[model samples]
Target: METGERRTATERTWMFPPVTGWTFDQVKDLEVPFDWELVDGVVVVRGETALWHNHVRGALVSVLRAAETGPYAAVSGQCVMVDEHNVVKPDLIVCDPRGLDVFEVECAPVEKVALAVEVVSPTSRQADRVRKPALFSANKVPYYWRVELDRDQKLAVHEYWLNADTLTYFPAPSHPVHQHKLITELPFPVEIDLDSLVGF
Candidate 1:
């Protein structure tokens, strides 16, 4: 019979042995330092975010939360289960309040999400620009927003609405409140001040 200490050592050694082909549930069970997303049974690990990244996320969340009305609330860094095989954590999400229970810890179902937003980062550019948008659209998420900060720190927001018939996103024109503000009406009426957000 194996001793307790011996068994503990063996378990620890094999605990995180290669996560390839893992399901969202499996990845969720692990003790990982960084957020993990399972895309097509492959694990995508997120790196540590920078100060600017966090600042932008905070400003965006504040804007959304302030404008939120009736049943929808802005949440940050929450895992969204796109399907059994795919799970992703968007930078910011606006979701139905009923779908989330503060007492329980779990990923929000994709159906409960009203809007998904990804703020571009150096490490996440490709996935944010391509994979995530496609996944959100396929799951019939009503709205998607992308925030891009250029080299000169100029901010731009791209909004898209899901076309139910085609199950794809069609770009929606952003309503500029002025030289520094961008406004949108979907999900809710919200205006973001790019100059203040980026310290321009």
Candidate 2:
């Protein structure tokens, strides 16, 4: 008979926000769960963010909807994928219209996305700065944005690409942190203001 708390090795489950690894059938079997991202076969649930984080998130959504005008679509805190075990929920996502397949009823594939962004929540900063970039680069994602909320008592912006090993951030000589955008070669080019996004 089982004893000592009856420990059992449970197979881990993985997912990329909104859509989980469980098929519709598997999902139906689950009674309770929260949003999560599976990276390197490890499942990591998104941590609850600060009010400032939420404020920045909502602000970005608003800016994308109201100020930045273009054919692109902006998504907030939606889980996306780089691979089966590598899933992420970006604070804000700006994608090319061509990548809409990922947002379909069935959801899009990993490579379909053009850009992925992460807002630096007190809890998520390390994963964003260290873990995600390598995964994104390995997957050949063209662009990535990292928003830092704790530096100098103000918001800081950073951007990366698969081509470079290190990340280049905002407050650029030509573009201030607020003026940066995630530009791409897609037919309908779209950009987001980093400063305005996190509410500087």
Candidate 3:
């Protein structure tokens, strides 16, 4: 099994920190400023999410906090398992607090989450909207949210939920805070105020 000191390197590929048989404790003790989410035995690091991305996160966190009361927790920006080679660092994650245990060094065994949110940066829009939706659904996460951002701190909220055949997202009806567009499926009803979310 690979250890922190034995990380292998290859050109032009994202670093795949070796943790083949390392314990969660070993993953956490690594000397790095970035937060990591481990799936199977691979490490995924999160780059800086843009400022507008954060603003939208704060908005949803407020709504989620007000409407629910339970042991479940809502967090913005954390990595969770998507599959053996695909570890995803969602913009926001809401899951059982008890499951934080799964986030140890080399693995997190969570399969479901109360909610998952991703705010789009130009650099990550493709990954956020297309890549993650498939991964989240394949893993059966219950709820997924996408917040799209454009110049001037403008934004859009796209909500997704499980559908019988595939995961889908429902875009807002009015002109988007940033005029972004999407398609989605949300089992529970949601009233998204696009303007307010982007400080219009």
Q: Which candidate has the highest lDDT of all?
A: 1
Rate residue 47 of model 1 by lDDT: 75
**Which 10-residue window of candidate 1 scores lowest in summed lDDT?**
5-14
Clashes of each: 0, 3, 7
Q: What is the lDDT of residue 59 in candidate 1?
A: 89
- Which of the two, 1 or 3, has more TM-score? 1
User: Per-residue lDDT of 70-125 in model 2, one digit per residue for the tens?
Assistant: 65567786666555445577777765556365545333345765666678777787
- What's the TM-score of every candidate structure? 0.84, 0.65, 0.63
Query: What TM-score does prediction 2 earn?
Result: 0.65
lDDT of 1 at 160: 87
Instruction: Score candidate 2 by lDDT.
Output: 0.56
By lDDT, the candidates rank as 1, 3, 2
Over 67-162, each residue of candidate 3 has an lDDT whose tens digit, in order, gives 445666666555565554455677777776664555453333446476778877776777787877777777777767777665565555656655
| Cα deviation of 195, candidate 3, in Å | 2.2
Clashing residue pairs, backbone N/CA/C < 3 A, model 2: 38-85, 102-108, 178-195
Cα lDDT of all candidates, in order? Answer: 0.78, 0.56, 0.58
Candidate 1 positional error at 21, Å: 2.8
Off by over 4 Å in 3: 1-26, 36-45, 69-72, 83-86, 97-109, 150-153, 164-192
